[model samples]
Target chain A: MTNKTPLVELRNMSIAFGGVRAVDDVSVDLYAGEVVGLLGHNGAGKSTLIKMLSGAYGADSGEIFINGEKAKIRNPRDARRYNIETIYQTLALADNLDAASNLFLGRELVTSLGFVDDDAMEAEMRKIMTRLNPNFQKFHEPVSALSGGQRQSVAIARAVYFDAKILIMDEPTAALGPQETQMVSELIKKLKAEGIGIFLISHDIHDVMTLCDRASVMKNGKLVGTVDVDTVTDDELLSMIILGKHPHQKEA
Target chain B: MSTPTTNRSAKTFFNKLGIDLRLLGMIGALVILCVMFDLITGGRFLTPRNLFNLSVQTASVAVMATGMVFVIVTRNIDLSVGSMLGFIGMTVGALQVYYFPDIVGLGHWSIWILASIAAIIMGACLGAVQGWVVGYLTVPAFIVTLGGLLIYRGAMWWVTQGQTVAPLDPTFRLLGGGADGTLGETLSWGGGVVSSLVAVGLILASRRRKANHGFTVKPMWAEGILIALAAGLVLGYVYIMNSYTIAKGALPRIAEARGIELTEGLTLYHGVAIPVIILLVVTIGMTLISTRTRFGRYVYATGGNPEAAELSGINTRMLTVKVFALMGALTGIAAIIASARLGAVDVGLGTLDELRVIAAAVIGGTALAGGFGTIYGAVIGALIMQTLQSGMASVGVDAPLQSIVVGLVLVFAVYIDIVYRRKTGA
Candidate 1:
């Protein structure tokens, strides 16, 4: 696997907020068709690290490479230009806008006169949403009126509809029901089969064990280790999360 | 249970017609207010002459209020608008009366056009500068515009040393539309017909577009009813405007100018005034901008959730500046109307209009918390406020009492809006 260039590589990424290193010198790589689970407790800086890659925040120091070429990502627009899409845990959505408006908030479908084509956008939104969640019927209603699962579905649909090459799902199934969660797992597998790379942030060890090819653990804004999911047990992952130590590292 | 079921059905009915319930409630309130005023004033309030005057009075404030919808929609306040209006009016007044005549010779045809262009540009630049302070410097909008309010007012004082500029050019004064500035009967009828046709066309076009896109459309009867309603409104307004006749003393001059032989008891209709027409154009233009443009979409998105907007790669800071610039440009137009209508620019021009415009937007159901407003709502809100003021005057109320009543109405309107929003969970 090391013989070929990985799809995305983050090298020695570091960022600080108010003199505290929120993410310190974390390096990770994901190959094509791979699911890398990011496991960490609260404030473990997993989100911060991913944010740098997603262009939500600029890193103080780091280099990101895509397909063996160094990429500059200073903002969310740049991230999108690189075909990177992030589904934030908070499900960032404009509460007053309808589903289609939120789905195409920044990038809108416009007619030749440069007017927003609401009908076309609605048609497109309905088409994708039918495939993502066929039960989602509140197409004209603001997302705030939607249920948690429905909102999650909208966010997922947005990320997937854009044909993103690198997908970042930050706790994608955190607010979902069992069936919805199962649907998301199946979606991840399907995207993987299409050669898309996914970075999954999860606190659930079982999810990481079942859905991920590799697991990278962090604690206190620092990386503990990266391990192949096939080799590590759930207990070892838990200890890494809680004790901030790798399974194979010697204890002093 | 029956009540709840009926309410749901009513909501669904309006939803099928593609009408906002809140907007319908506002229009209903306006109709009730007008009817009550007409009754209390012994039928004087609904007279064509009074209504015509009321519409002309509402034009300036209504224009500014339309822009305020955008400003407040983006969660910003532009307190400088009133002072900006005064300042731009003074500058335009001076340009037309003094500088332009000197440069292009007195009574040059281009004087009015040149002065107007200067006023709009000046207002936009000033507004953009204030926006820069708020967006780039990270200052709160309230402080920036508050400072602008004082500075522009004082600047107006400095222009011509607080002396009122008067005797504006003859052609320029037509924009204010007193007697000679009206469209007259034939043009007014033509305008009404054209407006009705366009309204019907838009409705049909949108329905066809929906059907073409394979989306469910309103029933044929609903579309027919909507078209009829729109046409009725246009024709009704034109009819009222045409009912107002000019004074008898001016009849001979109008007849002679039109090359008609003067006859006994000949009457001439004063159709829609120019200022009101200007106001209509502005209202339609602003409505289209708010609903149909990408810039408008960004405004709502940023207003709805700033973080989400930024995450979506919207240049929200720049959007703030652009919105303020739009507000400024509208204020410039308002200045032209106010100054031209009064036939001069004075120290008290546009005084306290900032409060009036903001109140109109808020009373029009624009939430101060942002992300909610409509252009038509703001215009109607202005009309409602103007009705209260004029109605009270015609009823023999003192000026101070009129102010008090208007203030109370503003508060009441906001309270109603709050309850409505909560009830609807919007």
Candidate 2:
């Protein structure tokens, strides 16, 4: 990797909830302009590790670095200050609100008169929607009336609108059909082109192989290894997660 | 293309109209009851004088019902409004006789406004306390407000010593009864005509604004017909008032009958009741706040999903407190109106008023689950309840029967709401 400063780096981070070490002494470096897949079994602490990065949980020990600067992310608001945004499995879009309103949920654009600037918001929403996914046309309709993929787009748009540099997506394509999954994958690629580093957490090996640049496996709250996606097959990544050993190490 | 557009527009019109159809059905039932009673009473039920009295009688409950809509929309209820009203009314009465007469050296009008403000503030404080418990402390609103019902009522009894306060100043009495003296009096004709026109105009302007803002407006024809019907009703009322006769000064003349001298023929109240006017103004103001403001949006969001709203950085806790405060302010306003109309206050001034207000909101089409309702619907609901009560009373229906009928109507209204929700998949 040519970039000297990793966009995000975790050093010996650990969190315990009532004596259960959900994540223990896990460290990883995520560079800018890359998609890193975090994969594990259901209780392997992959979610806990990513949650710590996204500020949903506080680490018990160790540290998190953003652009080589040590950071304290006590809450979601603090994580947002460091341009870290998470799109949970539920998407968290206000279903009753339209796309423009959902896009600026927490921080809405307001006019000089101190009212929401509907016109400017609608225009910006249109531009973003067209750029990210041309098929998205329901601008005025509430997100509740939208398809699953479209709702995901609204959530992603919200994060991207705030200029998120480190994006965490939890199972973005889990409940979606192939077409919708493709739509989201394309959006991820667009985000990647824009130099946004993404942590794609998923159990779907095909999704990781097709979309992620590097795959990281975790088992029992510990990092097994990180491997380039191009050089490793889905079977090798599966074995790494299950057996907790690198394929190259086994070959050697 | 034109055919498809027209078809789509027609469908949209029906969808929007469906919301108000329940209200229309209630109004229709009221009209039928009026017609039936008019025939039974030899045309007395439809008289200009009786109609005018009905409007005044419904105003207090209608005003409180409007505020109740806000609470109901958030999936909360304020069961203490009745007791709160009684407490506020007694306080205002005491203030007028004691404080206003002594320290302030104020006349009736000044005392009325000041007392109203005091009542509103007191109500708001009380509401905030309850809201804090429900919203911040995460207590169930039902339990909190139910407790408020008992607490406020007890306070009222203790404050007034269970006595009926009376002999309010003549000016205060005029505010309640002076307007319709003889049906043709200038106050009745002028105030009624002007206010009705203003109401119609405001409704039209709002509908137009919604359309211009890219919101779906009801069908133009439906709106036009509604306006025409309202205008016709007002004009018809004016004509009836013009034709009524009463003795002004030993000689018989056509004038609106006053409530105090109904024997001289149909004299309208000498002027519009102050309470009625206040009710209209507050209803319109609250409706606007709910439909066209940022705070209103937050109310809906908080009710819909509190967690999502908080994650979006909205101050849900503050919004909840503010809503309760607003409800409190409304209760105060209603108390003042009730006190003015009765010319006194007692510990029981607002007895059972809370149940009626909550029932009015539910009957008016507001969902008990929150996130969907309107002040106008609530007012209409209150009117329906009051109208049913008044209509049944005129026919000598017993109190138990009235209760039974009201309960059945409430159940039916809720059933309709559930079915509509299921149909729309909302």
Task: Using DockQ, give the best candidate's number.
Answer: 1
lDDT of 1 by residue, A94-117 (tens): 988999998998999999999999
Q: What's the TM-score of each model vs. the native? A: 0.97, 0.82
**Model 2 lDDT tens row, A46-109:** 8889878776678899899999999998766688889998887778666666888778766667
- Evaluate model 1 with DockQ and give the value: 0.85
Q: How well is candidate 2 docked (DockQ)?
A: 0.30
Q: Identify the candidate with maximal lDDT.
A: 1
In model 1, pairs of residues that clash are: none
List, residue by residue over B135-190, the lDDT tens digit for candidate 2.
Answer: 89978888998899898888887766877777665555544543432323566577
> In candidate 2, which residue ranges exceed 4 Å CA deviation?
A1-31, A43-85, A97-101, A108-142, A215-232, A240-252, B1-42, B106-109, B168-272
